[model samples]
Target: MKKILLLLNICIFILGKEIHAQTNFPYYQDIQEFKKKDSLKFPPKNGILFIGSSTFTKWKDVQAYFPGYSIINRGFGGSTLLDEIRYVPDIVYPYHPRQVIIYCGDNDFAFSDTVTSADVLNRFKILFELIRKEYPAIPVDYISIKYSPSREKLWNKMKSANRLISNYLKTQIHAEYIDIDPVMLDANKKINKSLYLDDMLHMKPEGYRLWEKVIKPYLIKD
Candidate 1:
């Protein structure tokens, strides 16, 4: 009986520390064929892959704004930076794009009981480590978490996490840090109503317009 209990504890410990694998969602194949009907090879010249949480997932007008560029949005809603870290091999690496714009972590802030702000930062560190190993030359860009007019309670925590990410980027030459937090916020430090949708979390068309403007200058061919 003691041996059985010990073996069970060992199994539980191993499972607890294990990182879960990501499967290619059925929607991914559909997303892979957007704007381009022709089959193509991996590592398309100047292809820009936009990845992350709902921010990337919810970009329906991405192509309309970012024309003359092969930009692909691979956003998975309700996911954190850690989930992206686990899935990049299938979602990002296969594409082999020159540039990747990662917009996420808004949901990661206390979205799951398992992940925290510090956990998000740690996941990003792990992600950067993986990127350095797998795709050293690729430029990784981080889109800042947006201000939520309604979730005032989480605002401080959000800002703190953003600062952490910005600070971490100080050392990475290929990583570009972007923050539209100022534009999204009003003088009161709350989300600007004009920029937000009815939900107060997602952006209205105007909010995305502002984001498009900020990101336009940073995009470049590799």
Candidate 2:
């Protein structure tokens, strides 16, 4: 009886630790809000899952952009690839998505100068492998990190990370690297300020419209 009680205590301790860790995590409230919404009425399975950073989270009308396709946007606060990996079970696993679209990694460079391009690439590979492990047949697309006017200095690092990820995806099956940079650039090959909001980091509706044109063809049709 004592042995059984000890085992039960251990299990409870481990569960408590997990809850504590989750609460301490960045954007924990956002994750809980997602759970709250899911509990209310879960999104339909087999939809396109967009999991990433503020770029996607700020896209409140992502579903409207892709009228026919069902989009599940699980993006939270300015999340990095590491954050995405940490919350994979919460965001990626629950849904049986037909396709997964990712847009992250730029924050890693912007947030910390110590984080190299290779670091971002490695983080992406980890996230990709996690998804592929569960859903090998489902198409996984990485939307190349865009050049935000606010993070102009990090553009070189972003470009490097983008190239690395793009090349890696080329070798993997059912993976595509969608480049939206060209469309976002102007005559001088700089990010168009008009597409972004006053902050110059997040996009306006016009930016999303541009993204729609590029991303539409790649989406899987039912």
Indicate which candidate wins on lDDT. 2
90-184 per-residue lDDT for model 2 (tens digits): 88889999999999998888889898887787778778987988898999999999989889899899999999999999999999999999999
What's the lDDT for all of these models? 0.70, 0.87
Count of clashes in candidate 2: 0
User: Over the stretch 25-120, how does candidate 1's per-residue lDDT look in tens digits?
Assistant: 434443345324335544464589888877667887798988888886667665676566656665676677788788877777756654456656
Which residue pairs clash in candidate 2?
A: none
Residue clash pairs of candidate 1? none
Assess the local accuracy of residue 163 in candidate 2 as a C-alpha lDDT between 0 and 100. Answer: 94
